[model samples]
Structures are given as structure tokens and as C-alpha cells.
Target: MQTQDRTNVSSVEAAIAASQNYLLSIQYPDGYWWVELESNVTMMAEVVLLHKVWGTDKTRPLHKAETYLRREQRSHGGWELFYGDGGNLSTSVEAYMALKLLGVPETDRAMKNARDFILERGGISKTRIFTKFHLALIGCYSWRGIPSIPPWIMLLPESFPFTIYEMSSWARSSTVPLLIVFDRKPVFITDPAITLDELYAEGAGNVKFELPRSSDWTDLFVILDDAFKLAENLNLVPFRQEGLKAAEKWVLERQEETGDWGGIIPAMLNSLLGLRCLDYDVADPIVERGLQALDRFAIETEDTYRMQPCVSPVWDTALVMRSLVDSGMTPNHPALVRGGEWLLDKQILDYGDWAVKNKQGKPGAWAFEFVNRFYPDVDDSAVVVMALNGVQLPNEKLKQAAIARTVAWIATMQCQGGGWAAFDLNNNADWLNLLPYADLKAMIDPNTADVTARVLEMLGSGNLSIDNHSLSRALDYLKNEQEPEGCWFGRWGVNYIYGTSGVLAALSLVAPQSHGNNIDRGAAWLVSCQNPDGGWGETCFSYDNPALKGQGNSTASQTAWAIIGLIAAGEGTGKFEKDAIDRGINYLLATQQSDGTWDEAYFTGTGFPGHFYLKYHLYQQHFPLTALGRYQAIFSK
Candidate 1:
């Protein structure tokens, strides 16, 4: 793993060899790898399947997962992301059920603590929308109070304001089946289930409600106790059948060959449960395929057990290789060349959902995977530009053509504010963000700090740099984006740490060395923010909650990201750089598993900070490898 033994070899070739090994070890025998995305969703999907498939009577994987979850409960008696101090409502409910599934008694100290916390926080009625839906199924909460997303919603035309495509990928997946299940209204009851009266707000289920005046859709589903009493008296079987049929078709149509629905497990689990409730047998091909997919998502450790949203070795490996090459690893090295080829082939030449959202661009961004058309984010494309710059392409004409096309595509996406949003530009209409069931807060937009820094860095590579209005505007955006505290805000990753790191990297290229510029100030802010653990971390709550202030336990991936930013700024010789470099390198070298991987369970990336976060398992390994390679190049020499 040492960087010194390899010399004069192309970084790409060396990267390919190393990445192949890395990918191979993680790949399941069934031909896929799983990564933890967010904590609550993964645990929820797994626990649901544990009860529905394995039966609630046993104490094996469910018991182990429950024990792990209970140990992670915060002082307030609920779980946060990655064993943090504060509790999130959705996370607590999901963990509570996983414990319940394992036959943990309500009188148990942990269970009692959790129940008290839930009651204190306005009860389960005030939990996030999705959590309420799950609680309703087990009779813990009443379905009447949940927002009205009637099954007829599936009948809404694409031109309608509430078309499925407008929703985020996660929401679309879950909403479709929820439409079916709610229409059927099959309430699963057991002796262990808690009643709505015991768990929700007093008199909550009986209360009548109306749509908020600001809602965009004219149709809203609300059920007063009087309204439900009247509807239940009238038999409407045919209408319910039609709604269920349409929703079942919707779910089956979207299921991937690999049994993924929107590449998120919650959608798949809920949809499969809906199908079974619709009387689809266990032997059904859809059910069989659905069950197999779950096996690929689980991760087992000696101390913890959990599942990831999806696996992504391809994306992680590419960025690590580029980081190493940028730090003077040779372009011809085996690892770099192999990684370059892998990435080159993965680029999206044809537009997908991103282009559809952008509405006016040619599709030329790098996807997270070889063929995922649903969510091709912008950060990966910027990273691809950096990676492509270092390796030699087999087809020079083709390479130049690809670079030109991709860079132009990114350039057009620059917003009025000068930064680049990941998927689309300037899509910041708050009116369009009115999903009642989704937990995501505000989304990333063109002014996002992380996107701006990445694009600026990529453009600095000479081939992509344009001195035109677009480039100048982008520069102005980055300059304007620097916070009064000398840090930038991270939209696609965590909080200030990610934002400051991104700003430093971008300013290093945009700010000329001749002028003493904001780069020094930005770098200093990053150094000041480092946690006492000799590593850097940022909490997801920083997206809108000013109170969180980028809080979290230190993690290796963020630590490496900070160091990489400093090195890219040409401060490799400074005291701050030296300390960061040594700490990051040592953390990686010491924590690496016997198989050359590292498992840092905390999420270091955010698709929409506070709204949607991800845990790229390989990020722990590849990012550190890249950072250490760069540090060794500068200091070891």
C-alpha cells in the first residue's frame, strides 16, 4: 500500500489494479455490493423485512440489529445518524420498532426511555410523515391524521402540478405504493401493537383539518372522524380495485432487473409488502426477485449490523485515483490508467432525468454508475473532469471531443449566483417542494458551495477553462459565496467543513498566486474547524439548523477531504498542511482492515444536506488512499 515502491508508472494503471482488488473484496458472491446510505431508512427497510419474512418470533439477525440500535440510542432515548448525541424522530421510531420486532419488552429500560421521549415530543403523531405511515400499519397511530395522498393520485396526468416526476426519487418510490395501501387500508394488528390513543397526540385522530393556503395542488386528502364514518358506510369496492391495479402496475413497471425500485430499499420493501397484501404469493417471481435484492444491501460487522441504501465502488474508486494522480502519481501507473478507463466508459453521452430536469441541455455528465439514469448528480461530473485531465486517453480526438462537450454542458448550468447545482441549475422554486410525506428539507441549487468549488477546480485544468461571461460569473459566485466567517456552506456534503474544503480547493485555482487572496483565509478556517480527534467531521443538521454548526463525531473521509483541499491549494509545505497530512495518513494506515478496506459507518456525503445523505463505504478507504498518496508525494520526497 506504500506509495514509494511505484514510480514512473501511470497512475491510472496502478489505480486500476488497486481498485479492482478493492471492488472485488466488497462485491458479493451474488454480484453486487451494498453501502449504507442513511441510518433510519436502512434500518427501517431491514427491520420490516425481518418481521414480514423471518417472522417476529425469532432472535437472530433481528436481535443483533436491535441490540446494536439500542446501544446507539442517545441521551434522549432515540437514535441519530451514526451513534450521535441528539435524537431524530424518524430515526427513533424506526429503531424502536426494530427493538419491538426482537421481542424487547416495553417495560425494558431502553424501551420505556424511548416511549417517554416519543410521548414528550408530541407523541408519534408529530413524527415525520413516513414514520407515521409505518406506525399506522401496526396500529400505533391512526391513518386518518396522515396527509391525503389518495390512490387516485396515480391517475393524475404528467402535466398535473403533482406529477410523480416532480418529487425526489425517494418520495416517488414510496408514494406510489402508499397510494395503493392506504386505499385498501389494511391495518395489521397484533397483541404487541400500541393503540393510537396511547402513542399519538390527544384528540389528534378525531380532529378535522384543511389544506394550508399555500398548497399548489387543488386536491388534498383529509379525513375527519365524521368523514371516515360516512365513507365507511358506503361500499366503494370497484373504485378501490381500480386504484390498486394502477398502483401495482406502477410498482412492477419501475422494478429494476436487479429488484431495485428507484435504487432505494424502502421503496422496494413497501412495494413488495403492498404486492403481498394484494395477494401476490411468496413464490411469485416479483416477490422472489425482491427478496434476493435485500441480501445485497446488508452489512455485518462484529459490533454492528446494518444495511446501506445502495453500493457505489465505481464512484468512490474514480475520485481516489484522481486525487492520487493530482498529487504527482504518474498518469501511466496501472492504478490510474485502469481507473481512468473505467470512468471514461461510465460517462453518460445521452441525457437522462437530469437533462429532463434541466430542460435545455445536451446530456454529457458522468453518472454515479454505468447505467443509472435516475440520479446522475453534478458533483461526480466535476470530479470526472479532474480525473480525465491526468490520464492519457487512447483516442486523442475522442478525448478532446468528450472533454469539450462535458465542460460546455457544465458551463451552461452555472446559475446567476455563479455556483453549479448538482443535477440542475436554478431550480429553487420553494413552491415546487411541497411533498407532505418527504423528510428532506431544502435542496442543493446552483449557488451550492460544494458544487461551485468542484466546477471551478475542474475548469482550472486549462482544457475546460473559459474566460467568457459564464466563467467570470462562476468566479464571482464563489467569491460572493464565502461566508463572513471565511467559510462556505456545503450543500451536497455535510456542513461548514465540507463547504470550507470545497471553497479552498476552488480558490486555489481561481486566485492567482501573485495576489494574496481569500485562499489563505479559507484554508485557515478549515484548519480551525478540525475536531480534537485529529480528524474533521460535519453534522448533517447544519443545512438549515444553525444550532448544529457542523457538529458530529470525527470521521476519516472528511479528514482526508480537508487535507486534500489544503494540498490542492499549494499549501503542502505549511504547518497546518503538515499536521493534517500526518493525522489523515496515520488514521488511514492504522484503521485499514486486513483486506485493505476501512469501515467508517458515519455518513460523510449529502445529496441534499439534512434532506438526503449517503454513506459511501469505499469513501473511507479510497479517499484516504488518495490523500495519503498526495501527502507522501509532497512530504516523503
Candidate 2:
């Protein structure tokens, strides 16, 4: 990370001043920083059902949630996953129902518009498997239409090809608890009279409501689901009782003392409902902790309340800390020191699920959320370790030891093809994506350029060059993965602009002389992608169509990514290539808000590519400062 030298330009200096101050003012007293992890209204919608299942809807403020849902409703009368996304079927259905549960009459204008959007899109039948799960539980949709995952899968050994361990951490955590629910198939009617009878395209009875079918692979899963349902109906399974016991044991053991299971809303909600199906009282200490953990995910305002898909204190703190350092904050400044200490305390000394497949690892990594010790993310761990390097911690010995452990763990966790996945080793089972139950199509975790390059960047920051075995192999993986257009595909981020920039930075930092050609090609691709407004942007649609890569209205975060990419590609120097860099810097200067912030509403972060997206509110603020600061470090006189 390069600290900026004070620049001659007044606007540049003033912009840095505003951003630094704005960041400092928001740090928590306990020394971490967090911003909202905003997804679509579906998170808010699911929380309404959570309240009803807990039987707390009458006590909790559904009206506040109503305000947030209405606020995000597009003029099309449907809610979207991100800004300017035409609309989505499942998201719209969830939002419409949540409002109705809040007492908004079906004939109300907002409800009418939402209902039209749902019916026009083929109604409840076409919604996703997970969405169908919610509707079925409330007695609106049929349990028969949903796909099944029999609990006996829990009994499969790790040696089995299709064991649960083959799935990603998020998928397994969600599926395990749901297995118990699948076995019991419990349906609780909070209000028996209210059903989604109005939203189905054909009348509820008239619609055949077939199980999901897409391909030959899906056909195989459909057959399995039907066979499982038949055996369940006959009570003929050999290990039925033992499978339930194993699943219950798994869910109970994974819960944190804080009530969080798997550090995601779906996992936590499923676990609670699964426990309820087994007849655990709401007053049980386990259920109480689960409720409290979810409550922690909710953000309330004067007139609004909404739930985050997950909390991001660990992820947010690492990014902000790193960007602040790169933007010229002192290494030992109080804020940085406190944040570094807080982060150090978060390192997992105990192994989680990742250890099941990884024997070379002891737990010395970090998770995305505060209490998710069971599932550490490779992306978050890399960023956090990098951020720690920039801070001048007082206990230098402790810091160095933790860094060494993290480095060793990261090195051994590389996948077979010289790439790295997010949470597990060698989880590139693409065949799983075709299952009828994989409607989200995000069941598997595969290696991509963004995560591989980020791993390289972390290794580089530790001063390990191409000489290291991991770096050499990963370089090959990244090179093979680059698109013909010179941009790499970004799996964790929006599209090519993000992947191109990240790879360029990693290449320049780690293997500049050896990989200079690759960096140059990527920089040129990023330059050609610049918008007329002197910034760059790529829509989420780019994931669906490669031709749309790096194409969209410019956003502050994407522009900063472009600017930083140019700098890291050795183009920020004023000897040449100043126009593009200067124009990019100027865009940041001109758009700077008076209060030392940048405002962006577009979603740049990816959850599952086209299926789910995130708008990191702080992306606009910190990324621009990091870009301008780097430009000043090189070009300022």
C-alpha cells in the first residue's frame, strides 16, 4: 500500500481530507467499522415470515418493515434485485406477500401493481425452489411441488462422490438443517385464511404444479425426489430415525453461543424451523439465541426496518482499514491501531468445516461475519491479512505469528488446478448446478480469476514473489482464465472491469517483469472501457452475456477500480498515459460530496452472479480515496 505524498493540487488534497474525516467519524468505539450489507427486498420479505414463525409479528414493528419494502418498490410495481434491473419474479412475489402480511389490502395501489407484476410473470409456479419453500410452509404453495433432499444423505461418508462435503459451505449449512425440515415437512399456518390464491397464474387447484424440471440432470434429481417422497410416505426407510438424529446433532453442534448458525439468514432461519419441527419450544435457550442473532442483522430507522442477508463487520473493517492506509493515513494512528487489534482478535485459532477437506490447515483465518467461526472465507482472510500488514501494531510479535499461520493455511488450501475457491478446497462440481433443487444455480463454489488474483495480491504484499510455488502455479491458473478481450471473468464481483483491475494490480505487484505483457493488455482493456464521463461501469447483466462486459453507466466504485487498475498497471506515472489517469482522477474530484463521501446506489458486489447482487454502501467512499491517493503518490509534485 502506497501512502500519498501531500499534493500541489488543492482539489485532490481537499477530497482526501473529506474522505479520511468521514471514515474516522464512523468507527465504532470497540474499534471495528461496519456498513449495511444491502441486498434486495427479499431479505426484508423473509424476515416477515421469520416473525410469523416465531409468533412475534404482532409484537414486532411490521409497519417499519412495510416502509422499507415500499421504498424499494420500483415504478414498474415490482421490486428489483438491484437498481435499474427491470424486475425479478421471486423477489417481487416475496415483497408483495410481506406487504400483505403487514395489512396492506390486496386492492391497494401498491399491492395491485405488485400483483400484476407477479401474475404477468407466470405467478407462484415459476418462482424459485427456495421461494416455493417459504410459500409451502405458510400453506399457500403445495409441498409436493418442492424438490426433496432426504436426510439419509447426512449418513453418506466423506469418501462418497456426492456427499454434503462436496457442496460449498453456504449450500451445506443451509441444506443440512433443511434436511430435518424435509423429513418432517412441517407446515405451520400463522393465519389459515390468508393464502397466495390470488397470485397463481391458473387457479390454485387448476394448476398441475409439477415439480421443477430443466434438463436431463434435473430429470435424474426429480426421479430421486419422487422416490424419496414415496419412501417417506410409506415410512419404509431403513435409517429414518438415525438420519434424523444425525441431522439434529449436526444443527445443534454448529450453533454459536450467540444463536447464529452458518452466519447467514437462510441457515439460521432453517435451523430454527428445523428445531421447531422437532418440537423445541421458542423459549428454549437455543431458540432464544437464534432469535437474538437474527435480531442483530436487522437495521432500523425512524420509519423503516430491514434485515441484511448477513452482517459484514469483519469484511467492512478490513476494506476500510486497508483503503484508509493506502489513502495516506498514518500506520500507527489510533484508529488504525484499534482496528488492527480488533481484527487480530478475530483470527480463528480453531478450525471449522474447512478443516474436513483440508488436513494441512490449522485455523488461522477469518470469516466474513462476526461469529461465523464454522465457515471462514478465503476472500475475507486474504484482505484482512493484507490490511494487518499496513498497520503498525504495538505487539509486532503476535501479529507476525498470526500472519505466518494465515500464509501457510492459504498456501495449502489451493485447489487441484492451481486455483483457490472461496470456502473449500476443490469444490468445482459444475454437474451439481443442474439439479432441480439448485434453482439458484449457485450450489457449487468454483475457482475464478478474481479470487485467484486476490490470493496472489496477498502473497505479493507479504513479499513472496513468483519464486514461491503457490504463486507460480496460481499465475498459470490466472493466465489460462483470462478472457480473449484481455479482461478476466469476475465471479465474486460484477464483471470484467472488476476482474481486469484486480488481476492487473496483482500482476504488477507480484511478477511485474515476468508478467508485464499480461498487465499491459488488461490496462488497455480497462482504458477502452472508460465512459464518456471519465469513469467506468458494468451492469450485473454482464454475467449473463460476456459481450456486455464492462458496459454500463459509470459508477464511483467502478471508476475508482479503473483508476486504481491503471495505476497498478504502471500507467499512473505522468511520463505518458496522463490523460486517461488525469481524467479518471478528475472524475473523482468533481463528484466528491461536500461531506467527504461518495454516493453510489448501483450494485457491484456479486452473491451468485445474475441471481443475487449486493450494494456495499461504503464502496463509493473508500475506493475513490484509495485511487486518488495512489495517483497522488505517483504523479504529484
RMSD of each: 6.3, 2.6
Q: Estimate candidate 1's alpha-carbon lDDT, on a 0 to 1 scale.
A: 0.62
Candidate 1, residues 521-631: lDDT per residue as tens digits?
Answer: 677666777676667777766766865654667777887778877776655224345576556555555565656566776777765555456666667766766676666
Off by over 4 Å in 2: 1-8, 215-217, 465-467, 571-576
Q: For each candidate, what is the lDDT?
A: 0.62, 0.85
Q: Looking at model 1, report the run of 10 residues with the lowest lDDT sum.
A: 216-225
State the displacement of the C-alpha of residue 310, model 2, in Å, after optimal TM-score superposition. 0.7
* Residue 143 displacement in candidate 1 (angstroms): 1.1
Colliding residue pairs in candidate 2: none
TM-score of every model versus the real structure: 0.76, 0.97
**Stretch of 10 with least lDDT, candidate 2:** 1-10
